[model samples]
Target: MSTSAGQPPYRDAEESVGDLVKHASEQISQLMRQELRLAQAEMRQKGKRFGRGGGLLGGAGVVGFVALLAAVTTAIVALDLVWPLWLSALVVTAALLLLAALLGLVGKKQVGKATPATPEQAIHSIKADVAEIKERARR
Candidate 1:
């Protein structure tokens, strides 16, 4: 059946105060469920961002580590030659410094991605919901 004049279907003289309260309760419950779903979606998106940021940082750390290994390996290989110990130390130190500078930049970028993992959509949606509720209450 169709609702009359935009009135709720459950409203009628035969319906007691208890019925009205129950109807309101049911509507509130439905609204809460919808809001929860919205929050879940927003949190999921935020979580993905956080995970991606972590993965990028992990990658940066691994690359930096490999660079260190490479520096050490190069130094060790040079040791077998006629190179002096001081020369080998200098080579490894220079390589380490270069790697640190490059990797530091990349790692900073990856860390920047992970910042402020707040659920923006959820916050906006909740704010809207609160505003709407307030507006309706004023009426």
Candidate 2:
């Protein structure tokens, strides 16, 4: 269809069809690029959140480790007054090792859970849009 009052005769159907196909292709490519950008942004956001969470967790773990060491030192000092120093030290070492192992396990689990925090909603939205576009094109 003519877009302006003084436009020439309308193009042939074949030319129009080619133009429509080209426009559709361009639109689809633009849409795909937009979707990719959205995905990248979402991934970067999720990465930042995970990085912050990981840093906090690491700090907490360090604090816990230091606290455990202090507790072990105090326990060994108190026990040494009543028992042999070597036995008290041995007991404190074993307790500290056990606490360290448990803390490590908990930290590992927390880190594992922090992965893939970005929601699948964006992907689903893109899929829905693609389906709708396909249906419209078919019609």
Candidate 3:
């Protein structure tokens, strides 16, 4: 009788019961290690995306301040043609605030999309694998 590993497992035509069980155990261990590495890599990638999105928000703050100042100055200058000087300033300020509100809502939406970057895919895969193994064991 040939005892070579090339022979299929869990069959009298090949390995003993012990050899088959050991092979299955080793395979399972290797699979788990691979899954863990996948999860780590996924989380690392998500972390980078989150960091980039967050950094963009910070940069947007500085740029937004400059933009506000420019808009106010330009609006007051342009609208002064028809309105009193103080009234022009007030009108420009109100318009600028409304524009800022719109932009703020859009920015908030974009930032919200990139947060809480968990290893969701890996977690789902792990759950599925566990369920399959459990079902097989029951059989």
Pick the lDDT winner: 3
The residue-level lDDT of candidate 3 at 15 comes to 76
| Candidate 3: Cα lDDT at 20 | 74
Question: Clash number for every model?
Answer: 0, 0, 0
> How would you encode candidate 2's per-residue C-alpha lDDT over 75-123 as one tens digit per residue?
9899999999999999888887897799799979977987666647679
Error of 1 at 76 (Å): 8.0
- As for candidate 1, its clashing pairs are none
Tens digits of per-residue lDDT for model 3, 43-85 = 9997798789889979998998899789789889988999999
TM-score of each: 0.52, 0.68, 0.67
Q: List model 1 lDDT by residue over 21-50, tens digit each.
A: 798778878877887888888888878877
Model 3 regions lying over 4 Å from their true place: 1-26, 110-115
Candidate 1 deviant stretches above 4 angstroms:
1-25, 48-64, 75-83, 94-113
Per TM-score, the best of the predicted structures is 2
Better of 1 and 3 by lDDT: 3
Can you list the residue pairs that collide in candidate 2? none
Task: Give the CA lDDT, 0 to 100, for residue 47 in model 1.
Answer: 82
Candidate-wise lDDT, in order: 0.79, 0.83, 0.84
